[model samples]
Target: MPATPPDDPRPWSIFLIFLRLGLTSFGGPVAHLGYFRQEFVSRRRWLSEAAYAELIAIAQFMPGAASSKVGMAIGLSQAGYRGALAACLGFTLPSALLLMAFALGLAGQGDALASGALHGLKIVAAAIVAQAVWGMARSLCPDTPRRVLMLGAAAVALLVPGAVGQLAAILGAGLVGVVVLDTKAQTQAEALPVAISRRAGALWLVLFALLMVGLPLLAHVADSPLLSLFEVFYRTGALVFGGGHVMLPLLQAELVPDGWLSNDLFLAGYGATQAVPGPLFTFAAFLGTAIAGVLGGLLCLVAIFAPSFLLLVGVLPFWVRLRTRAHLQAALAGVNAGVVGLLLATLYQPVGTSAVGSLLDLVLVLLALVMLMAGKLPPWLVVVTGALIGWLVL
Candidate 1:
């Protein structure tokens, strides 16, 4: 048998490719992942479908932003450490810069317009989340058992409003999936290639863990509660196992009780995040700015997203090896199913209850959902329409 040729080792080309993705990839993490699959897997043929799937699996398992981690893994696999850094920096910088600019613009604005716009944005966000729940249910809840698990999780979440409940529901669903779902059909899964050095991986992990633990403490000592708020929010971003939206409850826990920002302000920032074209994590920038200032905004962006970069760098080399194990894959599948259920539950409570306050709000939400699902309009367009409806009605 002929020996298989080694994969391409060039760094510069990969850097440029990811740089483009970073600049133009929008519509939050899910949209960005779609773009990535189009550009890297389908268009460029840099990775096989199996390889891409494995990377996604690994990303979904780890804490932090899944899309960002997947992008970093792709870059690392293609061109080593520099490639990973370039990919992460390129993808994250555009949104961070834009959000920073937005914060600056909002700094001197009167409260009324900002408040109204934020209200409209929240309705749109609620609609978008509803669409997400519907789509996820269609895909993840393949059978009656899964649907029951999902509904049960949602019901539990409705009864108990907190991250702990969400976590419990996810874990419970995973246990159910593992115990009830058939695993006899499981087949061998291929491993993706790792490109980073082992030493580099260890270093990255250490750095990520240390920063997450220390940043908040440092902020506390500085006598700046805003700085501490930024640190906590950022740490949530860095440590969360899902994407930007998954970080919502974690952020709410940190902010709502502390009185750093009211529930309304936090929700407003979240709504505005949906209006933006980049990662939903940029909402942190808005919240940080609202809480502290430009410095807070900057700090929040860095703290929240920094761990994603580190995890990508740390795990990319080993993830391919790690994912091929059947037990691990099964565990991940259960976790992902749980994540879907949790997202579904979230759609009903804070998002649905807060946005659908009035008859007009309900109408706007339905219209937005129609535009998004039936009309097949882009999310940004639906957002604009929602805003117009909100302005007229509210």
Candidate 2:
């Protein structure tokens, strides 16, 4: 049983606690989840284990930043709207401020060491992503057909290498699941209670869509197309389901074609993001910095993540009610499967193409995979090993 809600009239304490959490939690989403479980479930006894698990599922399924969404949900569970707001501010500010500071520093200097360090970081990124895919596949693709879908998606991504390819694979896999796969067991899966409200839901949906459509147009009108770049990324963060990897293509589509950043630069920054200890979404800081300057990085951070906060506040009141519906559960299962496929697809292109440049690179990736799958090393350690290998070999 969960503890009774604390009536601590001082919401400021909640803000400070999460603020400290945001600053100190250094691992990626998985690590952050562990931290939340410890703090909210074990320490405070604020929510039941089941409730915590349900929130994680919803956050993972909804997209944007998975850990951030989870943090927001935890906040809402404690002190309502004010609690959620405080938690978000606390969790996000630390990383955002740090990333902005880093961007500012990088903007002024063009060092050979930085370039070399980034090269190693790219290899680490590839290793970490590949590890994530393998781990997810073991859990999500237990059957032969699902494995086929995974391989098929990877092949399609390699062959087509674009947004269309990714979308087609996701849609195709979902259709197959809905039409052919046996969902009887899935149908019987327990549903989580919905806690968000209709008004909030409508507001979130509307704001998400408006930002998606309006930001680019506003950027065009303002004569600084880069603002459009920020807007597109912002919307992508808000609307994308699954997780950070799912947002990769959407981000690529927006930035690569528009000439905001070169492929090498974008890939390099992505690689570096893995090494940095925070939300993978903070990669937006790199993109923002590349586009305008420190301010651009800050704007991109706000634009990309603002919608996530809004959506959490808007939808959380009803999550408990909505999460339990059969159709919604089925849809989420399909979406989860699609997410696995998407990650598999991603591995071949930017992740595979950029990192695996030689036989040595292949060897390093294989070793990293083995460490991740068999040894069960934490991702950050794997990242460090990959970087060390790159530094020594590449």
The candidate maximizing TM-score is 2
- TM-scores of all candidate predictions against the true structure: 0.83, 0.84
Mark the regions of model 1 whose C-alpha exceeds 4 Å error after superposition.
Answer: 1-16, 28-30, 42-45, 175-177, 183-193, 197-227, 238-242
Provide the overall lDDT of each model, using Cα atoms, as 2-decimal numbers.
0.70, 0.69
Residues 1-394, candidate 1: write the lDDT tens digits: 1123244535676666666776777666778889988977776777777777777766776778778788778777667767777676667766666666666665566465454665677788887777877776786677777778778777766677775687677677777777766533234445566656878888998988887788867887898776677678767776465466767766775677678776656665666566556567767777778778877887787778777778777776565466555555555456556666677776776777877788877887887888888988877676666656556656
- Scored by lDDT, the top model is 1
- Error (Å) of candidate 2 at residue 239 is 4.4
Error of 1 at 149 (Å): 3.1
After superposition on all C-alphas, the RMSD of every candidate to the true structure, in Å, is: 3.9, 3.4
Model 1, position 251, has a per-residue lDDT of 77
